[model samples]
Target: MSATRPGSVTFVAVLVYINGVLNIIGGVVILFTRDQMVRASNAGAIAGITTAAILSIVLGIVILIVARGLLSGSRLARGLVTVVMILNAVSGVILLFNFQFFSGILEILWAVVVMYLLFTQRANAFFASRA
Candidate 1:
């Protein structure tokens, strides 16, 4: 059941790690700028903003965990990454509809690339062997 680690898997893992780091930074920024954000928004929106920031932080941590698992060729990691990539792709589509063309397109492209890499024959074999 031995299998070589695929380049695609490596690329996907690297990208996931980088994205996770960015997500962590964004979440931290949101937390730090909470005061100004809360002041600018209405009373009800304040709670939503806080919740979003917290969720972002949690999401970032989860992403990092998944990425680490992926490097170890975990089957669960592949499933988790697939789910995340799908959600990201959907979000990218929504972004496009909201007129954020560039970002939306970039997001979609990145998600697609990750998805492709994960499903490659070599990647699949590597994960299966590790299982």
Candidate 2:
């Protein structure tokens, strides 16, 4: 495997860590707040929370896989990161409309961080080096 720069590895690792934490928090909330969540489910609150939890868990797995790929100098990880960032941005925009009822700001921040990390010069360089 080609060696990636320390900075690039660090950035991707941080993103992976964030995704993992979000997943854990989401799962805990869903499992612990079942009654409260069920009550708000119909109003979109519970549904939203459940969806977010599932998505977070999925994303966390993806992040871990991509981080491993990146560290191993796989170019596919870069493309995956870009795609994930775009999807996240789109999701954030959709969530913004429901700002009053959700963690809209956190969604926006997550999108921003993903976009920034994926599009930065370091990320580009990392991919290029792998190529």
Best-fitting candidate, measured by TM-score? 1
lDDT of 2 at 113: 77
Model 1, range 15-124, lDDT digits (tens) per residue?
A: 88998888888988987887787566486777777788888989999999998999899999999989878998999999999999998998899889888989898888
Cα RMSDs, all models: 2.8, 5.5
Candidates in order, TM-scores: namely 0.79, 0.56
Q: What does candidate 2's lDDT look like per residue over 1-131, in tens digits? A: 54356574567766666766677677776756755746743767766776777776676677777777766657787677667767776777777786632566666677677667665776667667777
Error of 2 at 50 (Å): 14
lDDT score for candidate 1 against the true structure: 0.88
What residue runs in model 2 are displaced by over 4 Å at the alpha carbon?
A: 1-9, 17-62
- Candidate 1: regions farther than 4 A off: 40-43, 90-108
